[model samples]
Target: MTEAIVIAAQAGRALAEAARRAGLRPYVADLFGDADTLALAEAYRPLSGRFGSGPAAEATLAAVDGLAAAAGSPVGVVLGSGFEDVPGLVARIAERHRLIGAAAGTVAALKDPHGFAALCGRLGIPHPSVATDAPTDPGRWLLKRVGGSGGNHIRPAPRGTAPQGYYYQARVPGRPHALNFLADGLRIEVLAVTEQWCAPTPMLPYRYAGAVVGGASEASSLPAATWTVISDFIERIVAATGLRGLGSADFLVDGSDWWLTEINPRPGATLDILDRRTTPLLAAHVAACLGCMPALGAQPADAAAAQICYADREHAPVPDLPWPDHVRDRPRPGSVVRRDAPLCTVLAEGADRQAALARLETRTARLLAVLAAKKTHPEEAP
Candidate 1:
């Protein structure tokens, strides 16, 4: 059983599921303990409360090594969403094991957003106007963090506000798009092209004003041009950044101009969501990491869109998540449910985004109400 390691329990379980479907053994590792967690590979999403210390990094390294020894497999590390600062740590892990994603040197290429915009311009890719200072007209200048994911540290720049070591880009008005690409360290296999919708408001990290991913129209259903632009952009990104394995890119479509957005160098929250609908995600990631490229298959005409679910009213524990049998990513019993932690999500496929959004929303509210009531009364165990 070759082990595939993932970070954090939720993400680990997702990748593990994908790997298992593709005939590979999955292993999960994290600072947090889980009996349900797999045992073959040492991968986990960091529990920020548990083992988050610098200078004493040796202990963490030793722990990873111990797990690798026990599994009898060289670890293939998949960097989690929040582990952006630890490319060196990733490199160190790969030194003794198998590395699946981009190397530390390539990741360091994106130390600043302004430099990234310059790189895109050099490559003939459309990019937004960038400056260190906020433009006088605040209509579109967007403040972006250089090495952040999930829209963290992102805000709309106001006039006269000076941002430090960040990028202020001209916000182009258009539909948001995402491309989940799987590269075999050489060739391209665009797993899926998702038409994205976002909330029409300023975003706060982890808060759902509307949706980071409002809705999606799968690539197979849309115009072939959508996929063409997306494939070209992925090639440009790989050539510029030297990235491999699981990576997703975001772009803004403003009329005819498709402005480039930052690329997420790891599997996204939507990765498994798309995988649940299409080709095997985790298996493909592990295969690509080992230098294999899968076929480019079209998705269903109406694969359900991945909508972000957040709490507006006082959020309470979902007592027993009456999750539809189809939903994955089961939250632990003691996990906190707030704006920061997503309550739950759903998959809806139909003619349009409105129908899918509504169905997921109804299911989320009902299931969460049951969980929230238990948070208030723990004595009333399910």
Candidate 2:
């Protein structure tokens, strides 16, 4: 059987599981192994062994090379979650193995906020207004790192931080909406739109909580606009970047208008919802990354509105498990109560958004404590 290379442990779990279920061999890269991964795929290499010291370059290269040889042909490299610094490295490594659909150069574009913002404008996509050096007419603008991969560190101008090398943008002022999409350059399949609300306070306190402070449910349409501008923008980006695999774009909605907030170049926090509403966007993402377009077509998630729920999110404060070593989305060690995969994902098939949400709320209350984290994640918006 043919094989694939997945660089992330937590982020790549669904993809790895889908691949194994489809009868393909999966070689995961990680620093260590865990019970969660035992049934999922094979671990090929530990990234730390490669990055810990510059002198270990030869050893690192050898380790990745052995993995390429083992996977054998048309390998697909998944960059994993929270990996923003090594697009060039990922490109070089994958290209050497003749891997298909590796968009290293395109991903590098994320580094330039001004250039990327201009490009988005040309494509007729809606991006929040921005200026790198504090525009003369600063309008609630924010200085952000184009290389921001995700999690905390994304917030309003919080005094002194990445002062010099930062990109600026007008913050979208409304509830956050994220769309999970699978694209193969030629086609883009939007699977789900998750609606999230933050607490009056930032989720946690200042970014140590491993979990989200408030609650999140799947949303169907922007309150007034229903996200048409944002939807068109994603299609434009797919055409522009030729980005393959699954990815997400976050936005802020003000009435009917939606403004782009950030981009996650890989599957992110919405995976659990997607897997519940749709048949794992990862399966199709992997296929697209391989240049293979499965016959699957796009559709709204589970009957107009799918109600996905989460409570007691883990904060980043807990010790981060070794990179590339992911357990199913479960409660962390300090978690007084154990949790299960998804906590609770309810599909209100054929029900209106309200009915679906009601059912979801009732179901989630039954399964989770809905307890806020003792600490908060810095990047979490209020």
* Reference-based TM-score of each model: 0.79, 0.68
Model 2 segments beyond 4 Å from truth? 1-4, 30-34, 48-63, 72-74, 98-102, 134-139, 159-161, 197-219, 223-226, 276-280, 297-327, 330-382
- Cα deviation of 143 in candidate 1 (Å)? 2.3
lDDT of 1 by residue, 46-86 (tens): 33332234743455566556655555654465555544545
Which candidate number maximizes TM-score? 1
The residue-by-residue lDDT of candidate 2 on 1-382, one tens digit each, is: 5556544433345456555654566666543333344346675565453232254444445666766677665245555553444465556656665443337666666445676687778987777766755455443655565565433345565543346646666766775668767778755776656665432225322121111111234444554246555667787877787777777777777777667766666766545435442344556666788787665543443432233233356433333222121124333333332221132233333334555556555544543332331333333421
The per-candidate count of clashes, in order, stands at: 13, 18
lDDT, residue 14, model 1: 52
Whole-model Cα lDDT of every candidate shown, in order: 0.58, 0.53
Error of 2 at 378 (Å): 32
Candidate maximizing lDDT: 1
